[model samples]
Target: MKKIDNMTVTQIKEYVVTRQKEEYPNLIPMLKEDHRAAVKKIGQNLEKKTAARDQEVQRIEKMKSIESGYYDQGILNIGGIDEVGRGPLAGPVVTCVIILKPDSSRLYVNDSKKVAKKNRETLCEQLLEDAVDYAIGQVDCDVIDNLNILNATKKAMTDSLAKLSIKPDLLLIDALHIDTDIPQKAIVHGDATSYAIAAASIVAKVYRDNLMQIYHEEYPEYGFDHNMGYGTAEHIKALKKYGPTPIHRKSFIQNLGLK
Candidate 1:
């Protein structure tokens, strides 16, 4: 005689499971069918709630993992570095260095490419506010063409780290090691796997995106805003028609037979 409508989904399910067998002796078959229907509805609701909680827990666990690593090292001066524009044909290669607070373990930090753009932008702003130290560095298109992307990226990372107001005791770099006296680790796919690298990735991505948007205003013909200096069909067509711009990497264009 208890009202099922007032009970939560979890309570409804528990009640049904516990009472079904005992009530079978006295209940009509129709009543058992009603119990089955109630149980199914409750199960669906519970599953949805459980899934949402699981996702939240996973995000928390990821944040804890990063926090624990920094705690274990006992070093407050940990810097994360990441680069963007390695694959782009035009625009400068950019890198960012970020030193997060030891106690500020925020969830939802992951690779910039894995996250939505809006979330990346939001996180970039949040990290900037929360970081103890942060800096961005760039190597121009001419320099990228002269040194190549690999070396250019290294230089950008180094420059970003050098500009940091607080010196870092440890450097966590994404995929490339820079020549520095500071202890460093070059982690492959670090942006995807490490929280620190992921934060750095978002900063670098947002910074580079803003720069490309500015370039788009200057050169609307090449669609810099849409392609971000990448070699899309539109970009290639523009290159063929207008020739290389100052921002275009001459080495890459020469290799592609466009220069």
Candidate 2:
């Protein structure tokens, strides 16, 4: 049956399933704004679901049966370590060490940078419940200035490892080696390639983002709420207009003359 222009979007969707799309071109266009929006949302939902499924497949490919590999060698407590806030001009470097049970590995995990913020929060909660053990460490801007970002990040990573209740037999570090005396492997993109690292990355990212949100209230001038201290144009403009806040990294802001 030909779709009439007067049909509601609900009816239009039904007709679309039963008929070729070309038969109902005007039906959707004629829909009220709300109905048109609903139709658009349906399309968007399909794309999101497809993307999620593809991500799952890619994650499996990248992890490459890593969970089984650890188990085969009798390594039960495998930790993945990753950090965030290293590049921000302000705020502390945050690190997380996550040790996931083998069963928890199948959960959706990816590099914190790759996951959307809201989804990362959701994943963070799930990872926490699923993980065998986890710990978070933060080295604030003062410590960062003292030790430098590279060393500060390493220090935070080690701190996180030290706090874990269950000591990890093996460590999967993201692009940096540590002196913890624990055996460790550094993967160039460990967060994307390994479950533990990815989970840790999520924790660190969520933790730091929350900290910046709190900092936003203290120094509203820097636009910390929006830029999260990444030195965006808005943040830089505020820095020039208001000079430096206590949280600003002294060495990092040398060009801005915030001293």
The number of the candidate with the highest TM-score is 1
For model 1, the superposed segments whose C-alpha errors exceed 4 Å read 1-50, 63-67
TM-score of 2: 0.79
lDDT of 2 by residue, 211-241 (tens): 9999999888888877878989988888889
Error of 1 at 81 (Å): 0.5
* Model 2 segments more than 4 A misplaced: 1-55, 106-108
Clashes counted in candidate 2 amount to 0
lDDT of 1 by residue, 79-145 (tens): 8889888998899999999988766555577888787889889888888887999999999988987
Specify the highest-lDDT model's number: 2
Candidate 2 local Cα displacement, residue 234, angstroms? 0.5
Q: Please list all clashing residue pairs in model 1, or write none if there are none.
A: none
What's model 1's lDDT at 81?
A: 88
Residue 124 shift from truth in candidate 1, angstroms: 1.0
Measured against the true structure, the TM-scores of the candidates, in listed sequence, are 0.80, 0.79
Enumerate clash totals for all models, in the order shown.
0, 0
RMSD of each: 7.6, 7.3
